[model samples]
Target: MERVGLYPGTFDPVTMGHLDIIGRGMKLVDRLIIGVAVSEAKRPLFLLEERIEMMKEECGKLEGPGRAKVEVLPFDTLLMHFAESVGANVIVRGLRAVSDFEYEFQMTAMNEALNREIETVFLMADVRHQAVASRLVKEIARFGGDITSFVTPTVKERLLEKYRK
Candidate 1:
């Protein structure tokens, strides 16, 4: 049977950090599905379609061990439900700090309750991206700060575009 993994995130804009986790996770799992959660709680820098396009453009395509495949999806309902629909048994998450860990822990527990067959796996963010976050990145760019080093060129351009608008 094929092993499918889900990487769910609020990737308002695709960041190098997010890519880092996806790249690394691709190696470990047979397939990775990058799921962008449509959230209404926090203001986003980009829409789901834009974020998916940017991620696809940046990643170029997904290759995995054996016959693994990578795909991008926009999810609006319970993530566990999405995981089930994708036939994924594991969920990959990128943890940058204790705060992230706490939040992920709760999510994992909740997901576990929701789906017994699915398991949540956490991957620590690369040190370079450990300090970069959507909130801070948005704040910096809102004031005209450079974020090219933090996110992908597409993301930087999109941020600037939003700033201008």
Candidate 2:
């Protein structure tokens, strides 16, 4: 049976770390859906449409023998519902540090409770990207700091434009 994986995130701007996780996760699944969260819980620098487009453009560049069917979709409802809707039995996530573990553990436990069939898989961020994060990147960019190293070119340009304006 073909395995479909769900990688959900706010992805206010897709970071190199996010791409790293996606690339590694693709090899483990037949299809990988990049679910962009449209939650109002956190203020975002880029609009939902822009983020989705950015993710699509970045994910589009992944091509190889281990490439999975990549799709970027927006979701506002429950993550479990979104995963089920996309027919994803595996949920992919990235761990940047031990600070992220507590929250991720809680989320994974809750998600498993909500749907036993859905499994959460964790991938550690690459050493080079260990300190990269969307919030931190945004804070740096908002203060006129260069973020070219943190995100993809598309995302970097968008961040610069957004912060400049």
Candidate 3:
């Protein structure tokens, strides 16, 4: 059977750290779905459409041989439901620190209770990207700090454009 994996996040502005998880996640599955959550509660800086477009643009560059096919889509329902909808055999998550593990651990337990058919896989963020987070990236950009290292040039440009408005 084809192995499909789901990586769900708000992806307010897709960062290099996110791309790192995606790049590595691609190696583990036949297809990878980057689910951009419609998280109104997060008060995302970028609109859902904008986030999807950004993910698509960045993910496009990841396409190559021996890699899983990538798809970027929006979701607002329960994560397991989304995973099932995409036929995901695994749900990939990126871990940056112990704090993240605490929350993810709880989430994994809950998700496991909801559906044990799909497994959750966590990938440690690259050391260089350990300090990167979308919230922090936006904070830096808002203060005119250099965010080139945290995100791609296109994403940096988009963030700056949002701040300019």
Candidate 4:
């Protein structure tokens, strides 16, 4: 059976760190569905379509026509429901800090309870992205800080445009 995984994130503005995780997760699963979740409580910097578009634009750069499979999707309801919709049994997440581990652990436990068949896998961020996060990037950018080195060139460009507007 082919393995399929769901990678869920607010994405706010999908970062290079996200791409790194997606790149690594692709190797572990036959296909990866990257879901840009819309949260009511957390108003994202970028809308769902914007987030998805940025992710697609960056992911399109990965080489080897078929080295890995990817899809940019969206979910406003439960993540497990979305994962089930696509027949995904695994959830891919990236962990950068200890706080992240705690939150992801709780989320994993909840997801497992919600769907016994689904498993959430946590992958550590690449060394370069270990410190890059959407919140941090936005924080820096909001204050007129340079974030060009934090995210992909495309992300940097989009962020600048967002702030410029």
Any runs in candidate 4 off by more than 4 Å, and if so which?
Answer: 63-66
Q: How accurate is candidate 4 locally (lDDT)?
A: 0.86
RMSD of each: 1.7, 0.9, 0.4, 1.3
- TM-scores for all candidates? 0.92, 0.97, 0.99, 0.94
Q: What's the TM for model 3?
A: 0.99
Ranked by TM-score, top first:
3, 2, 4, 1
Candidate 3 weakest ten by summed lDDT: 80-89
* Per-residue lDDT of model 2, residues 70-110, tens digit only: 99999998999999999999999999999999999999999
When summed lDDT is taken over every stretch of 10 residues in candidate 2, the lowest stretch is 60-69
What TM-score, to 2 decimals, does candidate 1 have?
Answer: 0.92
Per-residue lDDT value at 58 in model 3: 98
Query: Could you give candidate 3's per-residue lDDT for residues 1-165 as a string of tens digits?
Result: 999999999997899999999999999999999999999999999999999999999999998999999999899999999999989989999999999999999999999999999999999999999989999999999999999999999999999999999
Cα distance off (Å), candidate 4, residue 89: 1.2
Query: Could you arrange the candidates by lDDT from highest to lowest?
Result: 3, 2, 4, 1
- Report how far off residue 68 is in candidate 3 (Å): 0.3
For TM-score, the strongest prediction is 3
Query: What is residue 73's positional error in candidate 3, in angstroms?
Result: 0.8
Clashing pairs in 2: none
Model 2 scores a TM of 0.97
